[model samples]
Target: MKYFTIFASRNDTNDMEAVIREVYTGKHSIEKTGHDYTVTRKSLFNRWRIMLRVLSEDTNLDYFESNIPGMMGFYDHIPFADEHRKKLVLTQISALNTMIAIEAEKELGDEPFRLCKELLSKIGGIGFLQDGTLLDYDGQVIVYPDGSSGPADFHPRACTRKIRGEEIESEEGERRRQASIHELRERGIPYLDTLPQLPPVSECRWKSQEEIARRAVALLIVIQYACDAANGGELDESKAFVMGLLSKYGVEDQLTEDERRLLSEEQPDPQEAVNIAWQYEAYWPLIWALQLTDSLDFPDRICDSSYAIEAVSKWGSFEELYRQTALRSREDILDAADKTYRLHWACVNSRIQGQDAPAGMIESIVMERRRGLFWMVGCGMEDWDHIPMDT
Candidate 1:
């Protein structure tokens, strides 16, 4: 399934409603996994809404790791305005999307309408389980006796009636919640409300979801191919499809002339070449996250790629050179790269402040770079225009 579909079907209330009908009657107007206009547009708008909601809630989503599902933390940032106001904004935006979806239904088909309503239902259905009582759809909890674990404890004829009908009594819910709290406390797990407050984003690096998805697609294809080749398996047919895409983007021809030539002399397989390329691509975020956490587990190849000489010969600037070099995994090379980066950044900062970069500072930085061993630094370029950018 497409990434957006998974998110949409699971989170969008309208989308859920559409599916529930299909589930009940075993009838559908459209097929799943087909790249139809309705599916594609719904997926697009779902992603759009998610991004906007993130921005509206946290305002700093561009900086640091946005607390998006499957991206980072489950909480990105607190809502910017009052919670009610945020909800109002989200509702208004969603309603507008519903209107657009209605128009799409008229032109495209009922499938769009079904998808929109179901997706909307999915979003609306989300709720917090308050206190310690897990409520049913009717908001009533079937309580158990002290020793029983089955619903037999709530047999209409056998159990003592505390409060009948829907909605767990507030007192009962509190009592159950306290019991759960006590148990968790004994195990040393923090309560949800008492957990550490998320700090503001300190660095902005991640771009739009589309950009991330494009990178992800490239990296996933390369890695999947690598795993297949690493196990002495034949090349996957999907490699050809990805290759075609690369060709359309003008990247395939470049790779064939340059990267392919280099790989032929080293890693003989085309799949391996792609894998290596993706390895280079995947390293960027790992390094960035590590830096923010002040934890290092990888080598810094951001300045040690063998392509550096050829790339520089081709008039590649420092940033391009660095991004290319960031692809390899040699320990000595990564150390040197990190040192170079540290020195370069330091020099830039010194110049910015009208201070002379200290004499032999670069040498000291180079020496200190040797201290990192067995580190698996990630690969990628820092935005040069943004000084003091995240790793």
Candidate 2:
């Protein structure tokens, strides 16, 4: 009896059948097409979008999974399937704001080692990846001269969630903090059950600019309390509160001892800070948008056109105006952002296409006037069907 290796057969149509059987039933359902929905990249994309939408409905994971690929981690963590789950996690979650790293020593063996090494190399700072043992979220790592780490070193007050209605609020208020922490522990099992392990800040870039701004906004919490005490009944009105928030986020340069003392000293006025909060709220979306497009150097460098749309629309408070200005055809890339953005793009495109612009004018005019141009510019894109050069 001669037993042959069927896998060595010239016609390998069987591989597709195996993929259909294994991958189809695994995550994505077998659709009317009678195949795994994620077989094609396009199909996988569709499935990913569906999963993202479903995940979005769950408010708790909003802080947990934003910019992080929540479901994709499940596939990578399957022990038999892949061991380089850390690297995969880093790649998927690196670009997004809001990263979390879990410690995996006894249970997560080898995974933590790879995660720590990558984090240390990519992002080096004071508490980013505490001794490559613990994970820090921001670019800053908290390293003491004595070599100790944890909340003690950097002391990040995480956003514990409180259920008020369908939405969740941060655990700033004392009463809310206690209630939220309890609810989080009870309801958070699903959110955390399948994580491979949390890598450090160096492991991945967590905390989008929006999240950072929000944390900085926490400094306002202190400011509000201080102002209430100072005013007695009136408002202790000043730029100190706003300045303190920016200083806390490290957006501003060096501060005087007076400013630092003030921030450390007292609480802010709630009513005054309440009015100020709207500006910070508006700033958050723009900050997030800036971080999103932070990678782009020249307008020509922007390869991902979808992000270009978002950068224009939500970068500022007036979402509708941007939406109208940026209303381009589905396939159109150039006309999707703002017209001022379009002008900057034209300059870049002009450079890339070897067209002549005023000397050094493109460089000066392109990115600088984006904020100003964004406000006044209108998008009256005439030709939507034409795909811009190289796009």
Candidate 3:
């Protein structure tokens, strides 16, 4: 049942009233019973249109000008630009609602009355007159001022200047610049050669062969967990399960005919199996992990190694590890894991080949898969300081 009225100066009051009347003819019931017009509508959208139509049609009158029965009215007569003046009016309204007299204070007996007086004093241009007219600090009535009263003249607060005469370089512009430079350098441009040359890839830090071996062992422990989870915790069953996964992912192609025959024998050397897995260009660590788990009886090896523990935590869980391996998949979880393993393997080989391999090459590789696996199991790219470069 609560109602509010939109008011403007007498000059454009008729126009404002006419706009509201035409827009809400059949949609809402509008009554012009007294000096003020009342509008009733069940739909908030129609009510909003009433306000928007009134303001859009009449540019002379301000939109914030309103009259509430019990509250002091506000008016800004200064002829400043629309943008700058709106900020001041909004700031005043915000201060009134939040800081001056909060609605909650009304529940505290006479606190609301006391706060209203305090608010009137703090806001310099607002006061309640004896004749029910709200006047600003300059003695200008906010609503329907007398004919002799004129709009106040004040300096416009906003001004504009060109900060830079030229357009700034965007991200695309920087990218284009780099591409151009690279194209020039590829053609062996003489000017580019005069620029300082970067230090050789051999000078950069790289993973030692021993570190790579240790990482291979750590990955095996992780694969063991997956194998155990899939095969009901039986060591022999888990080994067969892991071998099935490997064979599905083309791990068999990486091994020689002799190595494949040896895998059928009982009690194969874990180190020898890992070395054979390392010969492949892709999926080597993953293949090594699978083979070593089948050959070695290293229980709790994944939970104990810092690297394995970190890798599991990054991949979320061993059971649902391959879920984030790619943006798209072929329905089978093992297939997805295989694809992810191959991609990671390619990235590691690229790093070992050279430092300046390609622009964003390492980043592209990490971004294509789960970032955590690279840090913990792959090349430790997340902890870039530990990432080994080729000499």
> lDDT per residue, candidate 2, 1-391, as tens digits?
1110000001112233443335324444433232212221134433321110101112223433222333233322333222233333233232222221223212323432333333332332112223232233333323222333223223322122211111222222223234323433453211222222212112222333333333223333433434444555333444455455454444343332333444444464444433332222222223333343342233322234344334433433333323333222211111112222323333443444355632233433344334212211212111111111110
TM-score of each: 0.22, 0.18, 0.18
Candidate 2 Cα errors over 4 Å, as ranges: 1-69, 96-233, 236-391
The digit string of per-residue lDDT tens for model 1 on 208-242 reads 32232233233333444455445554444545654
Q: Report the C-alpha displacement of residue 295, candidate 3, in angstroms.
A: 26
Query: What are the Cα lDDT values of the candidates?
Result: 0.30, 0.30, 0.32
Error of 2 at 129 (Å): 32
Model 3: clashing residue pairs? Answer: 125-137, 206-388, 206-389, 207-388
Cα displacement (Å) at residue 81, model 2: 1.9
Positional deviation of 377 in candidate 3, in angstroms?
12
**Which regions of candidate 1 fall more than 4 Å away from where they truly are?**
1-28, 31-79, 83-115, 122-271, 277-301, 305-391
Candidate 1 lDDT score at position 343: 39
C-alpha RMSD values across all candidates: 20.5, 25.7, 25.4
Specify the poorest-scoring 10-residue window by lDDT in model 3. 156-165
